[model samples]
Target chain A: MSAKLNATNTLRVTRIASVKTENQTTKTYTFKDARCAKAKPGQFLMLWIPQIDEIPLSIMNTEGNSVSVTVKAVGDATRHLHNMKQGETIGVRGPFGNHFTQNNGNVLLVGGGTGTAPLLFLAKQLATKTKRLSFIIGAKTKNELLFLNQLDPLCTEQPVAATEDGTYGLKCLATQPLETLLAEEGKEKFKMVYACGPEAMTRQVFNLTEKHGVQMEASLERLMRCGIGLCGSCMIGKYRVCKDGPVFNSQQLREVKDELGISKLGFDGNRIPL
Target chain B: MNSNPLSTRLAGLELRNPTALASGILGYSPESLQRIAEAGAGAVVTKSVGLTPRVGYPNPTVVQANCGIINAMGLPNPGIAEYASEIRYAKTVLTVPFIVSVYGYSAEEYAAVAKAAATAGADAVELNVSCPHVKETGSEIGQNPKLLTQVIRQVKAATSKPVIVKLSPNVTDIVEIAQAASAAGADALTAVNTVRAIAIDAETALPILSNTRGGLSGPAVKPIALRCVYDIYEKVKTPIIGCGGITTWKDAVEFILAGASAVQIGTALAQKNPAVFQTINRGITAYLKKKKYRSIKEIVGKAQRN
Candidate 1:
């Protein structure tokens, strides 16, 4: 007997409407889905590329009936996704994960590499709500710094741009500019620090936020399957990165901080040093 | 479909429906467990807790294959002492029966955890004898009938609550173990845990799970689980909680017909939210109405006589 029926988690085939090449290794693909347009900042969608296997992608930007996902061609699945042509079909499964907590007052937004995808969306949302906002964008080089042009108009002051090679704004890590910014203005200037990036950078952001006593929320990355919290692959300690957070407040981050940047469990459940 | 005929009894525990939150899937915390109950599970089982806190295996703890997921979480849980508060908190919020699933290296340790759970207001204690990932415990204990019996007896002696011995599917004859648990005074039996299995990366020429091996659960193991329940039904009289790859209401029905009094859902919850319990319950209720059965008990084991 055919057991096939409409189930909640079934992947819906969506047409890729457009694609934007962000940098050398990163590209953002836009797909037509009304559900995603309403998705909160920091929520992710599981994209299926047929035989390549399903993987979670953060909603980079959304407008009208289209949602965009910034893909970094690092793994086999992502490499295959990068090669796909626009208008070709793919499966979209979510808008999953707990979103960043939005509040009033100034907020420091930091992002590095492709991790800038969700933070860019958060910045856009917070720009309308917060009294002030500043962005700290980081990458290995200026070419890899993401979303600075888009973030420029939304910030009260110039967004801090940092690249390892000194090709852009600051000649240091993303957190370095924030360290100076926080020290100059004091912790009360920025109500919270929001970050998503390399684990090492996120760890640094966490430490700076803690030292300054400023609240912080960070998006964590892990190998995940079944993004709704069933598969335990995306867990850091007791928390499921996909469920408890893709974005975690400082308090939540502190609980699982022991396992955070120290190591990440591989797809085979082996600990890989971060 | 809504004459309220879905309520049923498993051994002595009353259930509003046959659907339960199976152990090891989203049972890590009381908040999550309470949420699952709010979503419509008849009962909830906590993740198996041992005597001491365990970090469990490193990642790739759970991996998806074509048919199901292979997880070697190694039964990671806070020790009973620490998890007791979670149990108490969960009990205060839960309207459904709270079944604490416990595991340990020895019968004495199992009894200690079960006692703590019972004191913390667990409606039942599910002795996790069949978890395939953990060594010297789980299936290692469950695969041996004598050891399984000792563990069950110890837990039973320690708690006034119902004792459900969860069985392993890796055994040559699950019936032998089931009968032994039944004779040893197990109030009920969760017919199967994940089957011992492995997944490998064809590209990397390596095993996919961090532990290299894990137990498989999902739509793939339903047939095996059904056969297990059917076999145990023929040889043992204890109420069976069939739990392997039961993803739909129809799958739940098949287990009931095979003599499972209730079904525990795990892997399916990964695909969807806790709402699957209510969806399955509604579907089961509709099926019962369509079949002209007044209650699920009327259909339980109906296919076995033939």
Candidate 2:
């Protein structure tokens, strides 16, 4: 009757090596983590902030012996995470999920809000693999645009930046350039499009990518618990986003299209309009 | 996959592997159940469904506790009338046995749902007598030996398929309840369900789950569940299907050595992914090879002799 589990399956403590402000509401925390470094670009790690709650944050970047996650203080846990100083430790559980499947060819990357974090990680992985890579990022205002400087060198060409207020790059939404790109090239110029953003923006990406017949994989954000597939909190249709994906290809996205822009299950387990 | 020495039988039901997807974890839809089978579950049990439609408990249904999780998801399901189609759909794709878990407020409702599931092509029926969060449904019917007999008797009479009663760990003496279900004609017994528990927010001093209290599962409840199985095996003749915090192959083997014919895996599926079934199965087979045991039959209840 007496048995012990792999202790590593539970929360492991890691020290915050550094913190850098990404914007007013978000900060990138670099932790001295070796266990979580193996996480793929599209996967997420469950960050347990003591006394708050555990929340899933996309893996922003990983360097030698350290992993970084960009947190937007939209909720209590995120706010507590953003306020943490160096030398403080937090619990980390995973880098769980199926990551973005790399493809060879010219690529288009789209990011919105804090959604840019995982895309930034993906771009870093795809930098050398693709023939040419470009980015189109959007935020409510210029200050909210994440990882612009970090993404600059990674892009094969100049990245397009968009903000609704025209405070940054283009005044139109990020989808405008994508619409124009697909309209101009008709899916021939870029081999695929990778996007991570709000549901509305990602839904638009799904529509435009489908119209253009170009391959697209979008990183989806869903309320998650237990990051493993069991909790059922992160279900988008039959796919448990935590297990099957936080990343879904155009084809897989279509299967769950009914729930994509329609609704999402909330923290209370009730279906709420997206 | 071909049968190996690790193949096990509970009553007349045979499993290619000793690991099954326990009720209430990824058992909702046909596609998810199909994927679980592909991941290597010998059998997959559908989530607990009642006679009528229930949305279960509201948000904050699940939360991570010390070493596992607490969930008060009040058995949310589309009524059996509609879920039967889902069972049929799952049957189309699943190569393994599909066990339907049913719950009701009375013996008649339990028997009705079991009959509906059997007619819908369920290979077997698992009586969910122990969801700790829901009221007058799971634990209420499970904890009483007399009431347990009535429910099991009616269900056994209603369906020709094998009936497996999932017992609760909240009772004082689980062996008494197990003996009653076996004496009443339950084909097999799922040794234990989640223990009653709750989690609180430190800052607010309020219970974390929306339902206030929920059932605790994962590694934390393993020892208690094992003890129940060990205790029940000595008194009951019916085979025991062990569940509760079985995360690894070693965990699964421990349950079998403690007297479980096959073990149902729930919480481990969350952390290790669906592929965990195959990983645990491989580990079990390797252990069998290492110990020179002929089969799982040789291992079941071996601890009782000791």
Candidate 2 residue lDDT tens string, B166-281: 99999999999998999999999997999999877654456766678999898999999999999999888899999999988999999998999999999887667788899999
For model 1, the stretches where C-alpha displacement exceeds 4 angstroms are A1-117, A120-157, A160-228, A231-274, B1-3
**Which candidate leads in lDDT?**
2
For model 2 chain B, where is the 10-residue window of minimal lDDT?
Answer: B201-210
Which tens-of-lDDT digit does each residue in B1-306 have in candidate 1? 555688888868889999999988775565567778888999988778888877676544655555677778777666888778878888888899999999999999999999999998899999999989878999999999888888888988898999999999999999999999999999998989999999765544556566889998888899999999999998899999999988889999999999999999998876666789989999999999999999998988887975
Write down the lDDT that model 1 would get.
0.83
- Flag regions of model 2 displaced more than 4 Å: A1-106, A112-133, A137-176, A182-192, A198-215, A222-225, A236-238, A249-274, B1-4, B56-67, B198-212, B287-294
CA displacement after TM-score superposition, residue B287 of candidate 1 (Å): 0.8
lDDT of 1 at B230: 94
Worst 10 residues of 2 chain A by lDDT: A1-10
